[model samples]
Target chain A: MNIKIVKTDGDVEGLAEQKWVYSPSVKTHFFHPENLVEDVNGFDDSDYNGVGAVGSPACGDMMKMWIKVDPKSDKVVDCKWQTFGCASAIASTSMLSVMVTENGGMKVDDALALKPQNILERLGGLPPRKVHCSVLGDKALRKAINEYFRHSKQFDRMVIEGSVMVDPDTRITDRDIEEAVLEGADDMDKLQKKLKVGIANKDAYAKAEALMGKFMEKYYG
Target chain B: MKISSQVNKLLKDHKKHDIYLDHAATTPMDPAVKAAMDPYFCDKFGNPSGFYEIGLRAHEALEEARNKVAKILNCSSREIVFCGSGTESDNLAILGVARFKGKGHIITSSIEHHAVLETIERLEKQGFDITILPVDRDGFVNPKDLDDAIREDTILASIMYANNEIGVIEPIKELATVCRNKGVLFHTDACQAGCSLDLDVKELGVDLMTINGSKIYGPKGVGCLYVKAGIRLEPIVYGGGQERGLRSGTENVPGVIGFAKALTLCQDDKDKENKRLTQLRDKLIKGLITKVPKCFLNGHAVKRLPNNVNITILDVEGEAMGLFLNELGIYASTGSACTSKSLDPSHVITALGLPYEAAHGSMRFTLGHCTTPEDIDFVIEVMPKIVEILRKISPLDLDSNEVQEGHGNLHYK
Candidate 1:
C-alpha cells in the first residue's frame, strides 16, 4: 500500500517545508545586543587609542566601533559598537564585543587575529546569507588595530593596508581601488562621489580607474 | 504622550493576544467557501469530462461556478477561463496575446508584480519590443503617458488593477480606454482587486482581466482569466485540451467551487466591510505617524486600497521590526512574502523614488474580514515602542537631532 501526495503551491501535507532557523544564541544576542554603545559623547578621544568604522548606510549595513586599550598591557580594555543592519549583524557585533572585552580583554595582536568564523562559532551559527554579517565585526576590528598602530606612531605595526583617501597630497594605493570597487563605487563618477577619488587630481583618478578595472576583472572573472 | 499612554494601556490589556495583519499575502478560507468545496473533494468527486451521471453533475457544478464568475464580471460564461493561479493567468494573458500576434510592441508600468514584469522580460529576450512606462511618485501611470507609449505596432498594454505591496489602485478604466482607442488589447492583473473593488469588466472596458482565489478567502491554486469573446490567444501549455485548449489539464473542481463561493461572500457585504476597514486603516496610519516620528506613508493616501497601511519608519530595518512583532503575538509583513527572502529592497517601494534606506524600512499591514478595531488598537499601542527600541539601536539615527535631542543621549549597554 503506497500513499501518493499531490504537489501544489500551498502544500497542506507539508512534504517539502523548509525555513531559515536562527540559533538560540543568535536570537538572544539579536533581541538584546550586548555592550552596545548608544552614545559616544562621553568616551573622549584621549582615552581610546583606536576607533574604526566600516560598511555603509546606503548599502544597508554600517558599523562603527571604538576600543579603549591599556597602555602598559597593550590589551583591549573596553569595546563598544553601533550598527545599522539586520538581526544577524547586531548579534554578531554584540558577540564580538563580549569576546574582545571578556577576561579583562584580549591582547591587541590576538584581537586582530579574530575572524568571522570564530564569531559565528561563538554565536552558534547564522544563515548562509547572514554569514557576511559576521565579517563586519572582524573587519572593523582589523581597522581599529591598524588605527591603533597609526595613533601610537608605530607605523611598522600597521599590518593591513586599507584604502586611503585619493588626492594630490595623498598617495594612491591599489588597496584603495579595491575598497572603492567592493563598496559598489566601481566607475569613476561613483568613485569620486564615494571616496573623492581623482577630485582635483586627474593623475590620481586615471590611475585609480585603471587599477579598479584590473581588480574588477580579477575578482569578478 | 497621549498615544504612548494608549499603547501602554493596550499592551497591559492584551499582552497575550495574537493579531494577524498580513491578509494581503493570503487569507484563511471562509467557512461557507470551505463547505461549498467539501463535497466535490470526496463524495461528489468525478471527472467533469466523463459522460456518466456523477461526471455530469461535476460538469454542471463547474459551469455554475464559471457563470457565477461571469455574472460578477458582466461577461459571458464562455469567456471565463479557470487556471492554476493568478501568476498563471497573468502569464496566459501576456504570453497568449503576444504569441497570437507573433511579434509586436507591448507597454506596461514599472510597478507590476513580478508575474507581469518577468513575463514581459521573457518576451523581450525572445525578440519582442517592450516599453516599460514609469510611474509617478504616487505609483500612478498617467493616461496620457500610456497613450504616448502606444506605437503603431503596439499589440497590448498590461497594467495591474492594484499593487500588492503599496496597495495603490491604478486608474484602470482610463488606462484601458487609452488602449482601446489605440486599437491595442488591454489586460489587468486584478488579483488584488477582486475582493475590494468592482469587478464589472464592461465598466472597466478591458480586453482581459485576471483574478485569484487565495487572496479572497478562497482555496489557493485556482484563478480565472476573462478574455473578450472575439480575442484569440495561443495556448502556452498543450495537453488534454482543457480550458478551451488555452489551459490544458483536468479542471480543479473543488477549487473552482470554493473560489466562486468566496467571491459571492466577499461581494455580499463589500461596501460596509470596506468602510470599516478604511476607518481602522486610517486610524492605524495616523497613530503610527503621530506617535512614531520620522515616518512617512508610501502610496497615495486617498487612492489606495481600503485595507492597506504601508509606512516607512526612518532608520529601521523592516525585517527586524517584523520579527519583533512576530515575537509578540502580532504578525505583519515587510513586503511581498515572495521577495522577502532576498535582502534587496522592494522594487515597488524604490520605484516611488524612496532611497534605499527608506525602501528597506517599509512595512505593510493589510486588514481583512476578521480584522477588528481592537486589533488596530493593539498594533498602535505596541508599534511606537517597537519603533523606539529599534531606532535607539539603529546607527542611522546617530546624526539626527531627533534621536539625540529626544533620547537626551544614547543609553550605553
Candidate 2:
C-alpha cells in the first residue's frame, strides 16, 4: 500500500479510490428500472388503456408510456415505460413509473398533474444540465392521460401541457407544431408535411405557419 | 514484500476490479519516471537559474533532459523550449507566429483539438483570415485540399499528428510538404503521438511541434515545443527570460526530468510496445463490432493510433453505455451529449460527415500499459448483453428513417 500514487496530494498517501459520480437513488433506479415495457407485438396496447410517446431522437431523448386504468375507480392500475435517453433520463422514467403505481396506482388525475420536480425530488437530484431529461417523463405521462380521456369519450378532461387548439377538426394543437420543431422541422412546408394542418383551413394555416416560425426560433435559436 | 524485478515492478495487481482504458485522458506516471523525479522534490531542491553550485547542478540536469528530448525529436537542444502544459505550447506556437506576422491568413483542420482550433479562432477574430479544412469520412486531411487552400497571404498552418478522440493519424509529412512548397511554416500538435508514432521533426519536415508529458506516462504540467532554428516567435509569457525567451517561468525541474525519462523508455520500447498494443487494439475493435449490433469503428481502420478503439453503438446513448460499463469496472469515455458540459456531441465524429446520431452513441476506449487481451474479451462478452438490457428499456427504432444497413451487420426491425 506504500506505492505512493503520484496524483494524490500531501497527507493522503495510502490509497485513493475514484468514487462513482451518481447518487444512490439515481444509481439504483438506473441499474434496476421498474415496470419496463415488454413488446407484446401485435396487440400490446390491448393490455393498457392508453399509450403516448414524447420527444424525438433528433433532440437526443425520447419517452413512451403505457397505462392500464381500472374504470371502476378511475385509477391507474399499471404504468410501464421505455426511454431512448441517457442515464438520468432512464432513471427519471423508472422512478416516475414506480411513483404512479406504488400505492396501488395513483388516481388518473393526480398522475396527470405530476411535475418533473416531483420525480427529481424523489430521485435525490439529477445533474443540473440533466434536469431537462426528467421533464420528458412529465410530458409523456400527461400525454398518456390525455389518451385515456379521449378513449373514454371524456374529451373535456384532456389536458396537454403548453398547448392551444390550433385546429378544431384535425385536433392538432400548437404543441404539435412545437413537437414538430423539436424533431427538426424548420419551415412551414416541413411542418405541413408532418402534421398536415393547413389544407382545409387557409387562414388558420397561415397563422399556423407564423406559430411554426416562433417555435423554430425558440428551440433552434 | 513486493516483487523486485522488472516485470514485477512494471505490473501490479488490479486489486479493485478496476480497468482504466481511458489513456487518452491521461496516463499514470511510470514507476521509473517517478523514481527519476523523486530527487528534485526533496533532496535536490535548487533553482536552476540561481548562480550557486546547487543551482549549477539543477541547470545541468535540466540541460541533460532537454538534450534527450532533442535527440529523439532530431532537433538541436537549443531549438527545444519547455512550457507549462500542452495547451500553452499550442498557444505559444500559434499566437507567437500570429503576433510576429502582425496579420495574415492561417490554416488548420476541423478535427484538430481545441488547443489548435481555439487558437485559430482567436486569431480569426483579430482581423486575420483563416481557413479550416475539412477531413475525409475516415478522418484524414487531404493534402490536395491543403495545396488549394494555401493563399499568397497564408503565413502558417497548424495540424495535429494524431487525433485524441478517434485516434486518427493525419498525413503530417505530406501535408507539411504542401506547406513547405507554398513557403509557409508548419506546426503540429503531437501530444497524443509520443507513445506510438515517430517524433523526428526533420523526418516530419515540421517547423513547430508541441508535445506534453501526461499522455506518455510522464508527469503533468511539463511540455516541450520544438521550434526550428531561425523561425522567430514572439514569446507568449514574459518573465526571467528562461527557455530562450519563449516561455519565461521557473523551470519545472522534477517534471522535466520525469518527462525525459518517460520519453526515453517509450522510444526504447516503442517497437515492442506498439506491436503489443496494436494486437490488443485490433482485437478489441474487431470483437466489439462483431459482437455488438449496429456498431462501427469511428476513425480510420488502418491509419489509427495503436491503442485507440472508438466505436458507435446504435440504439443506445453513449453516456448510458459508459456508466453501465463503469459499474462493471470497465472505464472508458463517451462522445455523447451527457458526458460533456454542453449538449453538443463530439466534434470529431461530426467532422467525419457521418450521421449526426452516430455522435450520440460514440464511445472511445484508449488502451494503455495495463490493457490485455482478457480485458478486450471481457468487454466483448459483456457489451452485447448490456445493449440488450438497454434496448429493452429503449424506444428508439432506427428502422424508420435513413439507411437500413450498418457496417457492423446490424439488423433493424
DockQ winner among the candidates? 2
Model 1 lDDT, residue A180, Cα: 62
For all candidates, the clash counts are 1, 0
Where is model 2 more than 4 Å wrong at Cα?
Answer: A1-18, A40-43, A160-221, B1-16, B399-413
Candidate 1 residue pairs in backbone clash: B7-B381
B1-413: candidate 1 lDDT, tens digit per residue: 33234334534565454577888888878888999999999898999989999999999999999999999999999999999999999999999999999999999999999999999999999989999988887889899999999999999999999999889999999999999998999999999998889999999999999999999999999989999999999988899998889899989999999999999888877899889889999999999989887777888998988999999776777777776676655778884211254444678877776555666567999888888788888788788887776666666653233331222122222
DockQ score of the complex predicted as candidate 2: 0.24
- In candidate 2, position A197 carries an lDDT of 55
Q: What do the candidate models score in CA lDDT, each in turn?
A: 0.79, 0.82
User: Per-residue error at A169 for model 1, in Å?
Assistant: 23
Give each prediction's root-mean-square deviation over alpha carbons: 7.4, 8.5
lDDT of 2 by residue, A1-221 (tens): 11222344654322244455767898777777878764524326686878887665534567788898888988888988878778888989999999998888899888987977899899999776676566668777877888988889888887744568675423457987788789777876566544545533566688789898898778777
lDDT of 2: 0.82
